[model samples]
Target: MHDMQKELSTDELMGRFLNQLKDEDQLTEKQKRIMEAAVKLFSEKGFHAASTSEIAKEAGVAEGTIFRHFKTKKDILISLVAPIMLRFASPLLLKDVRKLMGSDLPLDDLLKQLYQNRLQIIEKNWSQIRLIIQEMQFHEELRGAVVENLFGVGRKLAEAFVSSKIQSGEIRNFPPLTVTRALVSMMVGYVFFKFVIFPDEGMNLDDEQEIEIMVDIILNGIRNKE
Candidate 1:
């Protein structure tokens, strides 16, 4: 699907992301405002450059109000990640992914659909994700949270799928975790290459074609050739 096809306003996007949080109902309206403001500011300016006071000003809340909900600026940053992890780890998303894994489509087609599903999610949450990536390098705690909370569960699912594929003679007999790692690395690398290296300006890459090539590369390397 095209990006504009499902484009949501920044308010709408943050609202939806917040809805995914388990503690969403527990959050006050002021807290939601703080989060929305923080996301916009963090995405526009790097995390280090964005301050809690700035977030409070943008949110139209007192600076002390922000601390009433969050312990520190870093706590606010970690809080943003909670909704993201919840979205992917939610039962509905897990069911969709499991369905894809169990489909009888050709490996290439399956991979393409998987790529689209994941890319859609990334596109919807790009603001928080970009900010998280930018700040993760400097914060050991954020790095650990992302790796353990964001990716840990998904990695288990991927490894299990790889194992099943190997057992069915649909893929190479490499270690399931290794195969999962390679596939995940390719997808993550493609995202970084698209956004960081050659973003919208000066580059005109077709996402569909790139996904096809990625699936081809994966199949050529991992498909059972016997």
Candidate 2:
């Protein structure tokens, strides 16, 4: 267990980061390929629509190889999506969350930077995000796995951040939980509207403009004050 001093590319760094979750399941190299193929196929073709043979073809493995590793297709789905969900639980992302919680940047500037960072991350990982949302609607196990493994730290961090802002009088005087929920609601709404609801190729705001406008609305309001 020694640390290396060499620099790693983003993909290599992510691969090493994910390998940390190998503590839970000892997957062979082939098993890892099968899980990745399963995720891609599941995202493209729905879980029920994708067959083991198709997964095998995508994974470049023999038909029986998938079955050898996974008892059933659902087993493969669980294995594939669980780790991807745990990407949220990564300490690397937690470091950013901690910074967000503790940073003394101006509230508007902090929020804009946070939203831009999140937008980039979500854009990069939209495939996995889509798979998680689609499957978790029906697969309680996948949903439960995310809550059990990831939400604890995230919820606490969010609560602490909100509480601190409230105490500092930077935020309006509202219940901490309510304020936290409002922040998440505003963020989710911004992302959905920008990316999905009202996405117009010709009339899109640049990331900085989009994030700043949204952060302004979140910090101030649309209502006219007397």
Q: Clashes per prediction?
A: 0, 0
Error of 2 at 55 (Å): 1.5
- Every candidate's lDDT: 0.78, 0.71
TM-score of each: 0.77, 0.76
Pick the lDDT winner.
1
Model 2 worst lDDT run, 10 consecutive residues:
1-10
> How would you encode candidate 1's per-residue C-alpha lDDT over 1-226 as one tens digit per residue?
1111343443443444355455768788998899989999988987778888899999999998987777667567767876776788666667889999999988789989999889878878988888878877876656665676557879888988899999999998999988998899998988888877778741577778888989888888656679
Error of 1 at 101 (Å): 0.6
Q: 163-185, model 2: which lDDT tens digit per residue?
A: 88888999988888887777778
**Model 2's TM-score against the true structure:** 0.76
Which candidate has the highest TM-score of all? Answer: 1
* Positional deviation of residue 135's Cα in model 2 after best superposition, in angstroms: 1.1
